[model samples]
Target: MLVTFLIITVTFAILTMLPLSRHEAWWIRGLDFPRLQLFLALLFTLALELSLLDLSSKQTWGLVAVALACLVYQAWWIVPYTRIFPREVKAANNSDSRGRIRIITANVLMTNRNAKVLFALIREFQPDILVTLESDLWWQSQLDILETDYPYTIKCPLDNLYGMHVYSRFPMMNSQIEYLVEPDKPSMHALVLLPSGHKVRVHFLHPAPPSPTENNESSERDAELVIIAKSVAETNVPVIVTGDLNDVAWSETTRLFRKISGLLDPRVGRGMFNTFHADYWFLRWPLDHLFHSKHFMLQSIKRLRSFGSDHYALFTELVLTADTNNEHNGLDADADDLAWAKRKTEDQNVDKSAVPQPEKHSVA
Candidate 1:
């Protein structure tokens, strides 16, 4: 029992600290996804160790200390997502419908043919904008029915799992699909004109994950995110970035993205809103996300029911408000974060001129 507890403690402690290195390898980056699970495992180990405490052995005490330390480390990264932490985005104070925007983002597994389930949810929620990732030609054709309600659309249907589609009820100005990293991967950007005549720059991304089957390293994903973050930082308009980032909300790269973009996550003080691996209760994380500028306040946010895909749909209603006084101060990038972002973008040779211009398309 002592040997088994020692191995568990040492192994988890190493996993907890592996992501601190900047290396983008699949193994190291993958560790960022299961921080919650790690915390639970460490908690369980700590309880068992204490129940079998043998103070006479210094080694047992050492094991307990390491396990407790690892547990705290994991909590530091995840505690902000709980209600215990103060919210980064303030709640909407008024009931103005014109400024309200309801959005739903789902990563409908490419092979999952249960399109009706998603369609049903859209009908019930009646979101102003709907973004779907991992959608292909079949999913696109199935979704054409939405055009009756959503007159403006952006479509990039590919057999590849990275395919994306955005259906909107509002006018989408200067909309374009760009490949930020890998050529086969595509991300959509548009200026959505709301009913209140306010234009919100919306970006929908589905970056490739670092896995043996996908990219061998996270460089592509990290570089693409940094490129977008730099662009968001320079833009003056209200911005909303949403999709299956394929990265956790609490990961280092995500924290860097938040700092550089200065966008606020509604989930910060609300809840984790874990959306991926819908089938496995224990193996889920917040993969699908929506981060918006401080100009918007949260009305409501919830994880919708699973629809045959590995990920559940994420729904958020945000109201654009002028009251900035109550909003949480946005994250600021220090010298190191800015330097790291610069290095990643430089390494990828991301040229602004290379990005394609908007290709206008309207269903009506």
Candidate 2:
């Protein structure tokens, strides 16, 4: 039994090293999604080995060392996300409510017909803006009632799982749908005017995930993000990018996005706020994300009740305020990283980084 367990322990350590290859094969890249899971499993195996196995052999000590290394490696990537670390988005004391905004992002599984649960949360929270993914025509029809309150809207409904829509009470200075990497997959972009008259650039994306059933490589997804990151870098205004990113927060691609764009993740020093796999507790990850520019600070963010979808809605409240301290979570990409980003973005460069001719349908 001890020998069998020792072999399994070494297997997990080997799996942890696979991501270092920077390969995008689904099995290899998927390792990025389960860091927390990996950490827990390592700890459990270590405890079992220590309590049951004799500590005489050098092999046993080597296994123990490898397990500890794996545990620490996973924790290094995740510790910044816990409360023990200081927040990247600071707390505001006297910010005006006019400068505040409540927003929710939910991926209402296209096949899940029960919209009442999601609509209920929408009613309860009454966010200033709502972004829904996998929102086919049926989901749009169900959300049509929201128009009475959220008159401003952007709709792009498709049977494709990548469908998305954005409804807002605040005025959208300009809004359009963009097919950045894949022609079939759509993302929404808009300039929103806050109640305080401040404007922020908002980009909503649902990039296709790398899977056997969907995209076979992460190149396209990485391109879509780096393209946007480059655009954000060139802009002077505040920005907020939110969606079911279909990528974990700690992945190299996501970290590159933050470094290239200079946006801050509120999840840093907060919590994982895992929003995916709402049905399976053991298999869950933070697939949905909300990243904002330095102009905003943390207010409140929570994972809300499910609406019959595979993903739970993420509700976040924020206040517009500049951080006095220059320091924040995440590292800046160096020359090598930037060069790689340039290559990735160029690999799938579009005609112009503009919203395509939108497939707009008003929900009245």
Candidate 3:
């Protein structure tokens, strides 16, 4: 048992350190399989400790050593809490004549049937643009009333976990349902016209996580996000990408995406929103995110009431500033991020020929 624990500890320790290495090739990140390593090591460690209560003192010490090592290894993931932006963007003494647009991103669980809660939240927030992840036909039906308030829409409702819906008050130009990595799983990409007639490209995505029920390997998911990073980099307009990215805010891939796309994370200096596993308060991270170009100033960000879903909705109000071109120090796009995006888009195109297609629907 001690030997087994040592092996697991060594494996997880090594995996945790992979992203720390400086590399230009994305496959190098394949070594940094965080979720998998964290899951398996903790699983076996707890199982042994729980079932083998009669172990001798020396064996218990060995378990303690292994457990301490695992905790220390995970400690690498904890970064010092710091503020990213101001406590609030709205000044108390100053009344600026700027328009505020509230954006909401919610992962309405496909299995959650409490549609009334979602309707109530929508009515309360009354966001200018709303994006729903993990939405299927049933979820789409529940949100049908939103169309009455928001005229524009981009719907791709699928039974697959990747189904997404986007509702906007302003007009959408050249919106399309795009499959970034696999068939059936689709993301929403659109050009939205703001109230001021300013155009911004918005992308909503919910890539599959590296779990038993989802894709076992995160390569495809990571690659697709890199593609999004590239897309945002190539766009001339201000952009906002929001969804349950299935990656942590501090993860290497997510960090790389932010750098490559030049998008600002609302949680950087703020507290961790940690909006997942609504049932289990302990096992949650900031899975839902809102990333935008520096041209926009954040007005507010909040985690909404927990709906009958696995995730808590994220609400962000932002004001688009004019001619804002501030550069952030200590930020640069890794060369590997560009390579990963190029390769992933190419690979996805090849797979698209063989990927499954969803049935046509009026709403989604």
Candidate 4:
């Protein structure tokens, strides 16, 4: 039993190391929560190994239980197979003072020089608001044509891959560039004034991944997001927070954010529009997302083409409306989440070199 368990554990670890599980498994082709599945498999393997070492008589039974758990999760993607994907709400039926707002979010790879593809995507969608990540001066120049259409803009172009930008047809108010953690890493925060005189707070974030090359830990990233979530909960205006969150929709941190922010995910009853891993089709997950407050109803959501980047664009349409009832249906952020957020923010202040650096600018 121990040998078998060890073999399985080593195999799993090796698979993860080689990025073999970067995309969805063949059996779960359409499922977008590949990371979640992988983590569950690891947990089961750990439980089996611990049980085998701890219990002599029930070792076989423990192995059997672990094996069963792995098999179930291996086929867990099927749980939502029969579930219907969320469909777009018809524009004719849109009942809101502010018209439908089309938002196109793309994490244009900082090094991807295919400006043509990026421009082509923008032309095809013609979104009302364009949010791009990993943008530097070069990317900003490539997006010059967009300025005429979207007069209001907030730009933060950096080389660290944390730079973000927002371009909108409506005026941008209370706009500011924030460095959540790690100096020079910037996140765009702005308030958009709609044509109807309504204000919508927009938060565009691209935190470092929990990879060896990056933060090596996700505490800072998780905490920064939690703070944003809490702020969303406190704000009175309708808010639309979107970007390459560097986290999955089903993550514990994300769930807490949703709950604390009282935000709605368009992907909840909808399909998982996996946007990352643009180079690999099967290995994609919904890393890019648009979370909105209850003041808006989802109109549509679609995954756009590869914009010469590592991630595909997520195009979403949200109809802004007034939240008359003040009913928030998200999970509540526990004390732990608040504590984490506060600690992370404080940590950022301690590091002198962690000052929020200026973004590389380009006249787009």
Candidate 5:
């Protein structure tokens, strides 16, 4: 038992400590998802070793030291995401003038036909902006009632499971679909005109995940996200990028995205609102995300009840504040980060034609 525990400890620790570079392999990138799990495993292994190991053995002590080091390292990365750390996005003061927009983003698991439960949740939250991923024509028709309350809408229902739609109470300025890395997969890029007349750039995306059914690697997803990051940086405007990102809130790709786009995540220092794998309580992750420019302050974020889908709907309220831009904690992108992002976007296999132009849907 001691021997087996040591083997597992060493293997798990090595896997957890593996560096995630800009390289685009699925296994390497996938390693970023299980920090919390790795941390817990290390704790268990260390406890077993302490009780069963031969105290006078130098080898046993060495194994214990390595396990302790790995646990601390894993915790360093995962701790910021837990309540034990301070929040990255500051709380918002009641902005009665600028307006508070409540948006809900959910991936309805294209195969799951539970529109009734989804609609019921929507009616309960009454979100100002509704974005759904993995939605098909049937899901769109089921949500057609939203057109009445959510006046401005952008819909691209696809059977491929990458379909996306944005329904907003605020009018959308130049709402259009963009196929970043995949030709058939679409992402929404538009300006939402608030009741206060302020325009907020919104990017709703559902990039393909690294799975056997999709791409065997994370290359394409990384490219799609990098391109969006660069575009948002050029605008230097208030923006909200939300969707089932298909990546975790703590992945290196996500970290680079925040740095490049200057968006802030409210999840930092907050409890993990794990939204994926609604079926399994133990094996779950936070695949959906809501990232916004620093001009917005956190109001409240909720992981709503499951609606028979693999993902739980996320409803978040944010207030657009004028003076809070300089106050929030956001990643600062450097030249190295810019170069890395460029390489990810302009990779040899990337089809430039498939990348949608921002002005394609702009009305004269």
Candidate 6:
């Protein structure tokens, strides 16, 4: 029993410190997802060890200390997402319909053939803007029914799982699709003109994740986010970035994106709202995200029912306000953050020729 406890304690301790390294390898980066699970395991181990008290044995006490340290480290990162911490984005107090914008983002697994389930959710929520990731030509055909209500659209249907589509009720000015990191991986950018005559810049992205089967390194994903963050930092208009970021809400890359772009996360003080691995309740984390600039306040945010995909859709409604003071709600990038973002963007070796010019399109 003692030997088994020692092995478990040491393993958990090593796993806890792996993500602290600066390595971008798939194994090291992938360790960033299960902080919550690690915390629970460490907590249970510590309690079991204490229950079998061995005050005379210094080795047992040493194990207890290590387990406690690992638990605290995990808590430091996981606690901010719980209700114990204050919300980063303020809630909307008024019911002004003109300034309200509703959005829904979903990652329908490429192989999942159930389109009716997703269509049902769309009819129920009736979001102003809908973004779908991992969508191919077949999914595009199925989504064509939405064209009647969503007059404006941007579609990039590919056989690759990275394909994306954006359907909007309002006018999307200068809407274009561009390849930032990988040539085959496409992201959409547009200026959405709202019903209140206000324009909000929206970026829809679904970067490749670091896994044994996918890209071995996370550099491409990090570079893509940094490129977008730098551009968002230069804009003064309202901004909303939504899609399957392919990273957890608390991961280092996502946190850096928030600080550099100065966008606020509505889930900071609410709940984890885990959206991925929808079939397995035990193996899930938040992969879909919708972040907005301080110009908007949160009206409602929810995790929708799964639609035959590995991921659950996210719905968010935000109200644009004239109060500039709300800008303080977002995190500001310091000198180090700016320097890091610059290095990440500059270090990527992107083939300029492979990236074609953005194509503009609109539907009446």
Best by TM-score: 1
**Candidate 3 Cα errors over 4 Å, as ranges:** 1-15, 18-77, 80-98, 323-326, 336-364
TM-score per candidate: 0.96, 0.94, 0.75, 0.76, 0.93, 0.94
Clashes of each: 0, 0, 3, 4, 0, 0
Give Cα-based local distance difference scores for all models. Answer: 0.90, 0.84, 0.69, 0.68, 0.82, 0.87
Residue pairs whose backbone atoms clash in candidate 3: 83-269, 84-269, 274-285
The TM-score-based order of candidates, best leading, equals 1, 6, 2, 5, 4, 3
TM-score, cand. 6 vs. native: 0.94
Report the lDDT of model 2 for residue 232. 81
Question: How far off is residue 82 in model 3, in Å?
Answer: 4.5
For model 1, what is the error of residue 140's alpha carbon versus the real structure, in angstroms, after optimal superposition?
Answer: 1.1
Error of 1 at 195 (Å): 0.6
Candidate 2 residue lDDT tens string, 81-129: 7899877777666658899988999999999998888889998998999
Candidate 5: give the clashing pairs: none
Alpha-carbon RMSD, each predicted model: 2.5, 3.5, 7.3, 8.0, 2.4, 2.9
Candidate 3 worst ten-residue window by lDDT: 355-364
Taking the tens digit of each residue's C-alpha lDDT, what string does model 6 give over 277-330? Answer: 899988888999999888998899999998999999999999999866566776
Better of 1 and 2 by TM-score: 1
Compared with the true structure, what per-residue lDDT tens digits does model 3 show for residues 1-364?
6566657656655665566664424444434434434645566675676566446667666666666566555544433113544331222232232445678899988888987997788889878898998889988887777888888998888887678888888777778787767666687877777677677778788887766566665666776787777667665677788899887776777877877777877666566777887888657677898888766776678899988999999998877775344435224766776666556557545433222122111122
Q: Write candidate 1's Cα lDDT for 257-345 as tens digits.
A: 99998999999999999998999999999999899988899999999998999999999999999998435566789999999988887
Better of 4 and 5 by lDDT: 5
Worst 10 residues of 5 by lDDT: 351-360
lDDT of 5 by residue, 127-151 (tens): 8999999889988888888898888
Clashing pairs in 6: none
Q: Which 10 consecutive residues of model 6 have the lowest summed lDDT?
A: 355-364
Candidates 1 and 4 compared by TM-score, better number:
1
lDDT score of residue 307 within candidate 3? 84
Using lDDT as the yardstick, the better of models 3 and 4 is 3
